[model samples]
Every structure is written in C-alpha cells, then in structure tokens.
Target: MFKIEVAKMSILFSPITIGGVSLKNRIVMSPMGMNACKAEDGKVTNWHKIHYPSRAVGQVGLIMVEATAVSLDGRTDPDDLGIWEDGQISGLKELVDMVHEQGAKIGIQLCHGGRKSKIPGKIMAPSAIPYDENSIVPEAMTEEEMYEVIAAFKESARRAKQAGFDVLELHAAHGYLINQFLSPLSNKRGDKYGGNLENRYQFLKEVIHEIHKVWDGALFVRISATDYHPEGCSIDDYIVYGSMMKEQGVHFIDCSSGWIVPPNFSERPGPGYQVPFASQMKKEVQIPTGAVGLITSGLQAEKILVEGHADLIFIGQELLRDPYWPKRAAKELNVSIDAPPSYEYIWNK
Candidate 1:
C-alpha cells in the first residue's frame, strides 16, 4: 500500500496569476490596518518592517498594503499612508523594493473614503448621509469636484507604479466612495451620479477607466457584494457591476461585505463567513476573485482553492497573528514554499 503525504502535495503549492503578476502560491496576505504610521504625519514608520516585509519573508504569494489614500483629504485617518505627495513616493518605493527582495509580489490598495472621509477635519461623501449625527455630515461634492477626485485617483496610480508597486487595487468597498454610491441606503441624490444602480455605478466606471489610463499593471476593485440592508444594494446589482468592471479590465474583485450599514450592534463573526460573496461573484462574473474575512486555517484555505470558490484566499487577522502563516500553512498542507536563507537552521532542525 502507498501512503500519500499531504504536507508535500503540489496542489496548494501551485502558482497563480493575479492581474499582470504571477503569485508563488494561492495563499495571500490580506491588507490589515495598522493605523501605525508616524504620529499625525503620513510618514511610513518602523512598523512597516514587522507589518509587511515579515509576511513576505514567510513566502506569502501576494501582499496588499492596507488601504492607502489617493489624496490627503481622502484619508480615513491621519496615520494612513498617502500617494498624493511627491515626497511620499520614496517611502513606498523602499517598501515595495523590500517585499520584492523577499521573492514575494507587493501591491497597494489605492483608496478614497469619499463622504466617509475623515482625518483632522470632517467626513465628506457624495451626499450627506451622516454616518452618525455627532459625526460631521459630508458636504456634497460638485460635478467639477468629482472630476478632481477622479484625477486624484489616476495620479495615485501613476505614483504607485512609479514607486514600483506590482499591482493596483481601487478600494471601493466597506462603505467607501464607490460602495457609498452603490448603496441606496446611503447615497441620495437627484443628479446623474445617484438614483438607480447604473447612475451610482457610473462614478466607479469613470474612476477605473482613468486609473487604467496611467496604470499599465494589474487593476482590481474591491466591492461589497451585498450591502446587507433591506433597501440597499443587492447581489443582482453586483452581478451587473461585476460584469461591467470586468469589461473595464478589472482583473478581479476583492469580495467583502456588510460595512455599508452594520448588521446589528453585536456582530459576532465566524470563520469563512464571507466566502459566499466571493464564491457567488466568481460563479457569476466568471472573473478571478479573492475571498476575505475570517479564513483561519490551512485546511480551510486549501479547501477554498481546491473547491474553485476563489482564485486567491486573503487572510487578515490570521496573518497578523502569525507572520509565518504561509510557511506554517505549507508545512501543515505538505507543500514546499521556499523559505528565507536566514531560516536554514529551521529546516535542518
């Protein structure tokens, strides 16, 4: 009788293509917020060491930096990284270079928080739907101002590419600008940018189209599949938007859900909870998609890959809890991931 060792299997060890870049494996490091930039300034700090390159050294296939602002005013916090300034490029260039030196690909999630925008001042959105009454209501952005925001996103992409990022993702999820517009539960307007799903989706189309103008790399949009509100955006709406996004050359969608409006006061999450959204999008749009949210085990991660649920699996808290998650996952699943030369002692041990 022959015994098969799962630890050395090649199934999970396979390389995959994300946009224009090739990943060493299907396991990915999901972007998790550190809120740890240099205090009150958008400077990259020492935290970037343990926060990013550590995961890359562990042989994670692809690493996405936490949502980085495309504009100063678009930032959710003063601590968030920004690409709007020429001075910021050097820091990002260094980070991207470090990740590449480790044999892993690095990407940046370019973002604009829109009306939900926050920092030292107030939150701003397409329309003023107060996130909270005490929270400042966003002033409506005029059409001319809308174009400037779009230009800002394009500039951010150009800077990211210049800074050596391998991929670019438009952060359109979690009730940010794009998702805010998509949700009937949030955006209320009489203009062309609001009303129906098509109108709401128009702003995103323009943004992606323009970003693609200067960015010749892999392009992606992160979208909330279901707004999870009774009168909000639905899966059907996502199908249409997903199809359109694919046409605009969006290589994949980082499928996540439920931040438009909180489901309940107490939202206890379970493992692989949001897999369904990614799975559904993969089935319908027929485009490569990544699944995120509470995917916590090697077996579960492998299952998502094996079952055709998603093209890639993104784990946030799991990676934070263990920077060597990819290495550990490889060992548990019997796959070989090239470990850093400095760790030769471990292999012999």
Candidate 2:
C-alpha cells in the first residue's frame, strides 16, 4: 500500500462543487444494486435504510443509491427499488433523510432494464434482440412507447426532487434501455430512433431534457464507455455523447465500461483500468468525470485526481468490504477527517 508523508496533503479529501451542490470531499460511494427489496413491490425496504446511512456514518462524501427502476416494467430485477409511483416517494424520502442526517449527500440512479430485465412478461427494447443466446428476445418499442418511457423518467425525476435527493443520475450504461438505443449492435431501428449515431442518441437526449424540466439539482449520467466489439461504440463515440450531455447541462459523467454484452475478458482488469475513459472524457469533452472500477486505495484515487484524470473517485466493492473506507483512506494519505460524534474519542485520537 502507498502512503503519503505527514507533511503533505491529499487532494482526495478536498471539496468541490458540481451544479451548485458542494460535496464534503472528492470521494463518492458508487451505486451498486443489492436487489434487497424482499417484497418485490419496487418500494424501499429496511435494507436500503440501513445500507446507505452506514456509509454516511463512515464519512463517504456522497452516497449514490443503486439502480432504481423508473417504471414497473423497466426493473432489472423483481426486487429492485422503484420510483415509478407516488406511493414509493415516502419510503425514498426516509432513505434520503437518513443519509442526510449522517452528513452525506445522497443520489439515486434512475434506470430502465430494457431487454435485460429478469421480470416476466414481454420486455421492450429499441430492437427485437436478446442480450445473448440464453436471454429472451425483447419486442421492438414503438415511437409511442418511447414517449411513454420518457414521461416515466420525467415523473421519476419529480419524485426524486420531492424525496429531497441532492443528485439524480440517469443510468445509460450496462446495455440497459438507453444503452440498447445507443449501441448500433442492438438498436436496429430504421426510423428516427436508430440507424445512425445521431438517431441512436435521441432517446437519451430526450430523457435528459425531460428530467431537466422537473429536476434543477445536480444531474449525472453513467455510461458504458466501450462495448468491447469492433462494431460497437468506442471512446470516440462517447466523446461525442459526452459533449452532447455537457450541452444539456449534465454535471458529471460517471465513466464505466463494458457489460454492453456478455463478459469476454481478454485479460484480468487491473486497478484504474477504466480511469483512462474518465480522463479522456474530462479532457476532450471538458466535463467533470468520476473514475470507477477497481480503484481501491487512497494513493491510487489521489494519483488519478492529482494527474487530472478524473474529478471524483467513485468507490464500489471496496466500500462494501469496509464502510469506514474513507477513514482508512485518510490514514493512508496522512490526512485527518472528522468522525461521527459517537466515535470522537477513538477517531480523534
């Protein structure tokens, strides 16, 4: 493990503002779906209430909730959290309040599963395609259906605002609904929604536009930077998409790659393997970016920020292994951070 001397400071502990919201530090708890809503009714559960606030108590700067379905049919799993109806707002509000009480800002990732949904019944996508040979083929969405999905997103944004969320993220990655539309490999539509880059981008563009109408807070987008196929989207394509998102007032691009299809890893990924994608977007598109994937240590995260590769450090599985990761990171970097009041004696020492 790398460590900094006591005389030096760590940039990872610094504060930065995006879209008028100031974070306590540069560390963010990346969203990871737990699928813990045991009732399977798309409502927040006891697990969500405990899971998110624990990170806040651990001192993470920002906590991003898992992929929440924007519509009932859009859920990736039967038990995923939802923001579809007004009834779900109260539960979400409770989760948000709990996180805020512990001094951490919370955000939610609004998502649609498209063809990848594990729920029963007919699923929809830009084309009648299956994610893989074992996956069921989804029906092609009509223009009217697309408009309905957009409306669902808009309504979900309104619900997010009502629930007092500090940030809202549209999940456009991981071969989901918006991703299926963006990727030429899955989006075979001949009409306005497909066939070319501009056409493919229309679905996400409209989702952002509609969400902005209701949400004035920080807006973020998580995207799959590459498809790992020669015929699929590459870094060059995301540069264009990143520029478009910037134009639409997106605050940050959460850069994550692959999973647009089944795993075909040529080699095992190393730490910061996906940092290059965030770095490229930050430099080329000139928008704030969050680097994720295998970033585990304070030194590694700090180096990425110090080199101007990304604006934020998004931690996933690491935070799960240790909720007090920020505290651990502070020690590694020779910095001090305020601990929760109850733990003052131990932490302050």
Best of the candidates, lDDT: 2
- lDDT per residue for candidate 1 within 1-349, as digits (tens), equals 2123454565556888877699888777887667887634665677886679999888788889989887888887778877877788888899998999999898899888876666766466778786655567788778997898899999989999899998898888887877787788778878999898889888899998898889988887888888777788877789889999999899988888877765653568677877888888899999998989988777777777777888888889888889888777766676666769999679535
Model 2 lDDT tens row, 160-199 = 9999999999999999999999999899999988988988
- Give me the candidate number with maximum TM-score: 2
TM-score of every model versus the real structure = 0.94, 0.98
lDDT of 2 at 127: 94
Error of 2 at 119 (Å): 0.2
Worst 10 residues of 1 by lDDT: 1-10
